[model samples]
Target: MDYRMFKHRMVNIVERMKAIGGNVSEVMIGAPASLQQIEACEIKLGFQIPESFKKVLLEFSSSCNLRWVFPDEYQLAGELDGIFSGMLHWDLALLKELNDDKNGWVKEVFSNPDDEYDKVWHQTLAFYEVGNGDYIAFDLVDNSTDACVIYLSHDDGEGHGYKLADNFIDFLEKWARIAFVGGEDWQWLLFTSNAQSGLLPDSQSAKLFRSLLKLSI
Candidate 1:
């Protein structure tokens, strides 16, 4: 990653997020930009990233704010797709239990719980090798719709990729080789993980909404 380039991109993203009313903070990763690392990523991933995205990466990596939103999952790595393959957490079992029953306690927690507060969950998991990368996953509580995105970098300071799905069912069928699954059921499973991961807590979640409110005002 090119520190100079990455720095430039981050500035842009921060400014844009600010315009959209996003919380920002400082985050740290150990490394400077290197050409060798970038080339290696391309050989591994077999793809190229658009110039527009590279600009975004430079900004996100060179600065901070590792945790922007609660529901977004950020995955950083030193290799191509190897980040997702690392230390996999088997939360599927717990997820399955939470989603199996509609009237279950877990379902209620995500639904009209706590004086009927409406909740929506979203996740972004960013995976990177040189600088920290992020991947995102998320879902809606009321309707239970889920989505995910994987951000990868390549060509040192020039190439990058972002893989995203509109919802969990789309991700499973289109990306994961799973088919014919009902959207509602799969979203419940994904949303359970979002809640369990603490990506969307009642307080922080409320704060984000407040932030949104201020933006609109």
Candidate 2:
């Protein structure tokens, strides 16, 4: 929990929201997740959680929003939320819902499951939702242990969507550098591609994506 970074940056964002006539909350740094709760989630995920991510849940707020009160404006810059948008609401119920939901989404997206097999839903530690059915998750299937942050579009699997960052903290820091706008699904694509693909400059998702693409090919 990089409390130092939040001191000036998040507080400033709250001030910005207030200046914009947005109804803001009281810097809602919600309660940290109990070890029991995290362990329960890990049991459901079928993978050990990343230590960095686990730390965020354990020491800091498990899930919270540091943004505007309304949904529309929140869509642009989002809340004081650490960029997960609605998906940041990684509540026990939501976590259960996503983890339990294996086949329902598969059935909808993969029209011919038997004929088409790239992996619409790779084993993922989805920490955020992209509004649509896609997710910003850790690639539980490939790099589950350390895991770079990757985008999981509904129709595309491992080989497709971009890998956003090398790790959890990097993801937040980079987005914070970009004012959380780059955290948006589209903004990520636009900047990374325009940079000839590495918005974080050291992002390894590109190499991982290439390797995954080979398997799919």
Estimated TM-score per prediction?
0.24, 0.67
Model 2 steric clash pairs? 66-79, 66-80, 66-81, 67-79, 67-80
Write down the TM-score for model 2.
Answer: 0.67
lDDT tens digits, residue span 1-217, model 1: 2445434444443443445444544434333324454445434434332232233333322212332221134322222111121111112112222223322322444344343221221212222222232112233222332233322222221112223344332332232111111121221122222322321212343234324323221
Task: For candidate 1, give the lDDT.
Answer: 0.28
Off by over 4 Å in 2: 22-27, 68-89, 101-103, 111-117, 155-160, 182-184, 194-217
Report the Cα lDDT for residue 21, model 1.
Answer: 46
The number of the candidate with the highest TM-score is 2
